[model samples]
Target: MLSAVAGAVRFVMVAIMTVVTFITPFLGKKEGKIERKAEECKAAFAAISDTHLTDSFIRLGMFEFGLQDMAEATDRLDALVINGDITDHGYPEHWQAFTDTLLKYDISDNNIMVLGNHDTWGGDRTGDYTKENFIKYSKEATGREIDNVYFTAEINGYPVIVLGSQSDHTGPTFYQDQLDWFAEEMEKASEKGLPIFVFCHQPFNGTHGLPYNWEMEKDADPTEGGIGEHSDYILNICNQYKNVIFISGHVHAGLSNTEDGTNYSSVEKVGNVTSVNLPSYEYFDVLRHGHMVNGTGFVFEVYDGEILLRARNFATGTWLENYDVTIEIEK
Candidate 1:
């Protein structure tokens, strides 16, 4: 009888916790403030990812509309970065749809995109998910020749490094050559005494409170998700830098905290690197606030001493108040 009662108590506790997790977002709302300390000492940008654009006309239409709203909202954005997963499937049609939507909005020139696992058919889907096609469609949509998926560019005079995986799509993998390139880039930025913004499609594994399934199945390879074979190498390289803002996506988790009160879905810091996981612009098994309000993205405003990340739903013109985060920029 004692053992049975103990088991029953445990079950009840789990059930109660689950209920609380689902309702917490409604109980308290968090808001972020944007205070400009200096006019010349700051820049602003916007980011959203995991669009998973499909070939459906309805879906494409919705995305098109959302793009319009996003553009209108961030009219003064210094840069607009679309992190990855531009298409749901590695299909030519899906890519075309995504391109069409961006072109229609006249926001193509403002975007800097990367490739996600979905674009490479890293999941169960199969197709000609080649780098050639990725660049081809990307250029068609943006009207810029992208010879390399990974490159560095200056955003408001800041050295920003963009990274893409050439292997192991779902989880992330950086070949030795890629790692070498990253190290060189970081060295260059460090030598200049400049803060760097690193953008990738996958978040770092294990550090953000993401579950094991995020990287791989429980029984599958232990090294997947954000913690792939080259995670340590990449992270170690990043840690060597002083101020590195690494942003990623792919996990379509919601913008709310999980049942354990962990908001691994948003901003987190490990070592000298601050990692940001942008919430999906589409719908998925959202752990926060049930589902996203569509057209969800973040606006980053940099000040003299800190950065403010404010989450907003362009489709609805409202902010996810509780999801705001402020990171102090290290001197």
Candidate 2:
């Protein structure tokens, strides 16, 4: 009788344990696979930033994507955001080669392109590479004509504005000047009640090494200008705006967080004015290169009212980051 009772107790205990285990997962809120994938595919992008290199097919091998990876991401991504550096000095042939590859891409109107200093062979003031010229080449490659050195667009129904890469990294461009124009556009969109996304090559309030101009003399203070070389000016201006998501390139800058026992820059900060800094497309950079290598781009998942930010490593085919971020215009 004792043996039989022990066996019955063990059976009952095992049944209780199995029941608890099966139902425990449902006790708390969990994101379903469909919802998770919806976030991933919503704005999945393979953004390569900085890429200040001359042109070469072999050098581009490090583009984070060869033929296979390119084809895969192409199928799922909403678009690609080439933050800047389309070419190494407005070399027509070089740009042609890069565009040739881009032409083969399965991008759509949703894909937004921003010009970098390397793209302009000459600065914006010189008119060497005017909006017309840049848009002309862009049209030839993607059949879309980009107008204005600074303009805004929508991606997967998210706000994204394309600002030209500065002609001279020497001084600040008074990017604030563009705010009036930017505000005008935002007002129109605001009337309609839509979100806004902003992207540029340089940081707004630069105060760092790459974007900062040293005194040419020793221990001299950096000329107050761009965000990367300065501090708070740009961030303050941006903070004043509403429904704005800022994304930037240049400075080889990044935002970092610790995960699984590793320290990494998952977000790009241009002198503390937070934004996404895309990595370089250059196969090799002979000049002031990464204080940190393995640069990547941001994948912004924009759902209704809420946007999820993710930093994806193209090399590993995994997301190194995931964050719930908010960027909305004030009513």
Worst 10 residues of 1 by lDDT: 28-37
Q: Taking the tens digit of each residue's C-alpha lDDT, what string does model 1 give over 1-331?
A: 9999999987876565445333433443323232223465467777888878897654565466456655664345666787888788667788888887787765424577777877877343432345667778867876657676677776777788888877535876566777899999999987766668899988876655455536335454445457467777888999998778898887766564453365454777788898888777754343344334445678777776777887766445456657777888777
TM-scores, all candidates, are 0.79, 0.67
Show model 2 residue runs off by greater than 4 Å.
1-36, 39-46, 64-70, 122-125, 130-132, 165-179, 207-237, 258-274, 281-291, 322-331
| Model 2 worst lDDT window (10 residues) | 283-292
**lDDT for each residue of candidate 2 in 1-331, tens digit (9 for 90 to 100):** 9999999987876565344333332333322111233633445444556554345543344442422243455355566677776566666676666666666756444555667765676434344354555776776765655666677666665556666643444333435556567656655655545455667665454333332322323354444324344234446545555556566555444333333222333343443234654444332211222322233455565655455675544433445434223432244
Any residue pairs clashing in model 1, and if so which? Answer: 30-321, 30-322, 205-226, 215-225
Local distance difference test scores for all models: 0.68, 0.50
Q: For this target, which candidate reaches the highest lDDT against the unseen true structure?
A: 1
